[model samples]
Target: MDDMTVRGRWIRVVATSLCGVLLLVGTLFGADDDFPFGPFRMYATGPDPNGDAKDSRVEGTDITGRTVPITEGNSGIRRAEIEGQEAAYVATPSRLSEVAAAYAEHSPGAAPLQSVRLVVRWVGIRHARPTGTYRDEVIARWTRP
Candidate 1:
């Protein structure tokens, strides 16, 4: 083999081995409750048949007293959008009022939002079928001042 060909093959082998080591280290030591490296716990572990499925959504009451579901497209405020701002939101949930105001401005057809609330609904899933009835829990609320 030519000298250049041998050197190129060694470089490829070293690069592949280095990547494998990185992935192993990251998976072993770089995991958190909400963040995980490759080989997610969800995929590694089996789903609990009796576990409850919970969904969270931000909703609001309009001036007309109608209920409106706040969405990312409408309110431009998604929990997922706050990637690095979870702590900030936990500290001052009233910050959501700013989102409510923006949503009211964009949704002219709908009456202005009178207040906003975070609703968490959960239902038990047994063998992939919804077993228990639905339950709603309002954890947070913010009204326009």
Candidate 2:
């Protein structure tokens, strides 16, 4: 081939390789924070290896003052969604009230919820053995207006 043809082929190869690398790097770092191009990082990282394990669930108090555990099926929302929004809830508690409204609406014939709370019951492990210990933390709560 001519000198110009060889140079053009080499440039095309270099550009293609550069674009591939950029795409891979973007995918590795961008997750659960952006649009359709990246991965869903909701459960990408497991519980901290050094920290205690946690079992998370959402609960709410009804108008009758009885505590009710919200479920994915009943509310069309899941624990993972709750966990995902925990940070935003902590920063702005009013978001919980919006979720509570949805929870109340989803449960037919049940007394509406007065308040919603995200409670986590966690326990530490030692050497991969159960310590027979746990504690509850009320992460966030929002009451209906």
Candidate 3:
């Protein structure tokens, strides 16, 4: 192959330098929104060794009073989606009705959900080890009237 041109070498140097600067700035100040250039906090940090670990899930009470798990297969809504918007759901519990609606649309033949709730199970941990104990808390709920 022929030797690289002067302008091509300059372009490569400038691009590499710019990328390094962006990465430095992102590491120091960027959040998840600046991925690829910014650090992903989830991977950058470790969980508290002696703290409770949160396990979030959505559950529904059918019209027949039976508890049902609301999974992506059943509701077409992923667990991550729920966790990602957890604050919004907690702020407005009524929004859980949308999950119930999604379940209804996906499972037409199944019993209808009478209520939907976001539940979090906090498992106790000590020295990075699970203690085989957990407490469930309801963070949000929506009931059909």
Q: Measured by TM-score, how close is model 2 to the native structure?
A: 0.69
Candidate 3 wrongly placed segments (more than 4 Å): none
Which is superior by lDDT, 1 or 2? Answer: 2
Backbone collision tally, model 1: 0
What tens digits encode model 3's per-residue C-alpha lDDT throughout 10-78?
A: 999999999999999999999988988999999999999999999999999999999999999999999
Q: What TM-scores do the predictions have?
A: 0.77, 0.69, 0.97
lDDT of 1 by residue, 1-145 (tens): 5566878999999999988886788777755453443556756677677787877777889888999888877877766764345445456779768768879777767788888877778887988788867889776678878
The positional error of residue 37 in candidate 3, measured at the CA in angstroms, is 1.4
Q: Write model 2 residue lDDT over 54-129, tens digit each, in one string.
A: 8888888999999988888768887788887888888887788877777767888989889988888888777665
Model 3 lowest lDDT segment of ten: 32-41
By TM-score, who's the top model here? 3
Question: With candidate 3 superimposed using the best TM-score fit, by how many Å does residue 54's alpha carbon deviate from the native?
Answer: 0.7
Question: Which runs in model 2 stand beyond 4 Å of their true positions?
Answer: 1-16, 23-50
Candidates 1 and 3 compared by TM-score, better number: 3
* Whole-structure CA lDDT of model 3: 0.98
Whole-model lDDT, candidate 2?
A: 0.79
Q: Arrange candidates by TM-score, highest first: which order?
A: 3, 1, 2
